[model samples]
Target: MASQTDDTDRITVRLAGREHRDWTTYRIDSHLITPADAWQVTLGIPADALPDTVKPWAAVDVCLGQDVVLTGRIDRIEREVAKGTNALAISGRDGAAVMVDCSAPIFTRRKATLTEVVDLAVRPLGVSQVRVEATGAKEKVEIEPGMTAWDALAQACEANGCWAWFEPDGTLVVGGPDYTAAPVATLVMRQSGQGNNVLSLAVTEDVSGRYSEVTVLGQAHGTETTDGQHNIKHQETDADVPGYRPLILVAGDCDGAAEAKRRAQKTLMDSRLEGFTITARVRGHRVSESGKPWTPGQRIQVVSEPHGLDATYFLMARTFLGGRDKGSITELTLKEDGVWLPELAKISGGKGKGKAASAGKVVELS
Candidate 1:
């Protein structure tokens, strides 16, 4: 279990099924946009305390108190010995690291389901368990010879309006966030120190990759039996972009106008993911109210008078820093709203209907 005080939280690492604690410093970074979470630790122990013989590539489980935060293999280990000091450092990434580094299975299947495609991408990588929460009609799936496992899974998931990620226990999950879920915690920043729980908060607004409009042009190839030629295209506009900046994309996989529109919409969502970001730094690795470790994809309520923010934000990423000078700290990366919808705007009703702009707006911290 993680030992927690009012100020800081403790961490433990189980290497080859043996638990070890008392690290001098550690940093665990987890995020939703990235492929995998990363972790590293430094141990300041005496020469005689280095009794364990475990080397690099050993299976490891990192826990924040009782919750397993990361499960993977150690990637590197470094040892330093001074005249009177000895230090050891270990670093690794979560199970998704393997999927990001290794190539997926190269095959083509006609009328394949999401589960079948996910199986092809993960099974060869030794990821046995898979939970696909989203469903879609069967479609033809083709993977190239050198595509990364993460890329293969992403392509499959995006077609179904879902995303793929690994759980703490190494289970591959294919699903989308439930936007209706309640906020887990409320973060407050007051002028007086009495009611303030946040150490520091920062917001960043970027529009480099963001576009005012996106157009996807695609051509449907004729089958062997037929020689029909068709041109398919779709366009989406971003209200957030004030200028006339436009982006044009060519999608070879688009089958029709609908597919092309989805592709264009996804581009807007990607822009929103990079447009605005909020960073919150707080003490302890866990939330004070829930007593649970900070996690990605959870909604958090923000109440900052200085920033004039009294809205809910989504937690896109969080980093846990232990053994710092002040105490254990959690740095949260937040988006304007939780979850990145392909439209980047709320859908009102059915197909061909206009989308309503999102309630949240990008705020300039300056």
Candidate 2:
């Protein structure tokens, strides 16, 4: 009976238009920076219970309850036999898998809008739904040979201090978190063991790649007719870095001094991301208060006096696990808030297409 209940749990996977559950083992992994969400499931059953039509490359939809969470295609399948019972396992990635695996459509665009770049990179892969919520000025970018679709899209978005990720329904979204939205749930780790919902909270702090100061230098031409600038530099300091460890990088190119500052700030944030992370393990797969799965890019309040931690964090990754041997578990990977948004400049005036003044330099490659 317990095994039957486990197989009929709320999570289900639809393949080839047929919903399937009763999984003997399952794992789902999703991340904010990763292009694709991945999932795997295995089952041991009589050979007759297996579907002959279910094969690799078949379209799949993963869902919790009635809401879909992932739209992807199967990548691999394995079959094994032991003691006259056959076990079948399959693994796959979401729509962005193609972007990560295939080369981008080669193109050189002049003064390209962010949305345009995203469409150019993903549409060829049969992903026509793309949204760019993060604001940025029209950029002159060249997507040369050998770049993957994901690389091209990420480069254009990251240059503007934004990121590209897929929505549950397979729409590509280019934006940062909506900081104004309220936190969905609070994880309390009280020393008194009262009102605590957290099963385990682990904090990791490493300073190996962290630094107090970051300098970014670049060179670039202003426009088609204007002269290019050289030696454009910007430096940003991180008060969080307790010691004076400086790092400098030569940025390949910059739109101006403004872009230089943005680059420097992004570097500093990257250091912060590397320096600290919080991992929380909790019972069940959904947020208690919201009834929704714990999702990446959401804000979560964490109060743990034992670790001297009392701040909201950005959920950057989440994983769900459950099988015959274990109950449902959700593991959350979080980072300090506001560090994910890189704060790149956006164009203003005249439909947000106007170019800002060049403040830095764009370095040329030899």
Which structure among the candidates has the greatest TM-score?
2
Name the regions of candidate 2 deviating beyond 4 angstroms. 1-9, 107-112, 221-224, 342-366
Tens digit of per-residue lDDT, candidate 1, span 1-366: 123333226677877556667678899888776887899988777676654645776788888866888888788889999887788898998888888998877654334456766767778887877887775535455667788888877777777667877777777777766545567898888777668899898877788988888899887777888553367878888766779988999876567777887778778777867887779999888878888889887878777777766777778889999763536889999876632753322322211111212424321111
Looking at candidate 2, the ten consecutive residues that score lowest on lDDT are: 351-360
Residue pairs that clash (backbone atoms under 3 angstroms), model 1: 2-65
Task: Tell me how far the alpha carbon of residue 111 in candidate 1 is from the true structure, in angstroms, after superposition.
Answer: 8.7
Candidate 1 segments whose C-alpha is farther than 4 A from its true place:
1-8, 51-53, 107-113, 137-139, 225-229, 324-326, 342-366
Q: For model 1, give the RMSD to the true fold.
A: 5.2
Tell me how far the alpha carbon of residue 13 in candidate 1 is from the true structure, in angstroms, after superposition: 0.1
* Candidate 2 residue lDDT tens string, 158-185: 7666788988888888887765456789
Q: Candidate 1: lDDT over CA atoms?
A: 0.73
Best by lDDT: 2
Model 1 lDDT-worst window of ten = 347-356
TM-score (C-alpha, index-matched) for candidate 2: 0.87
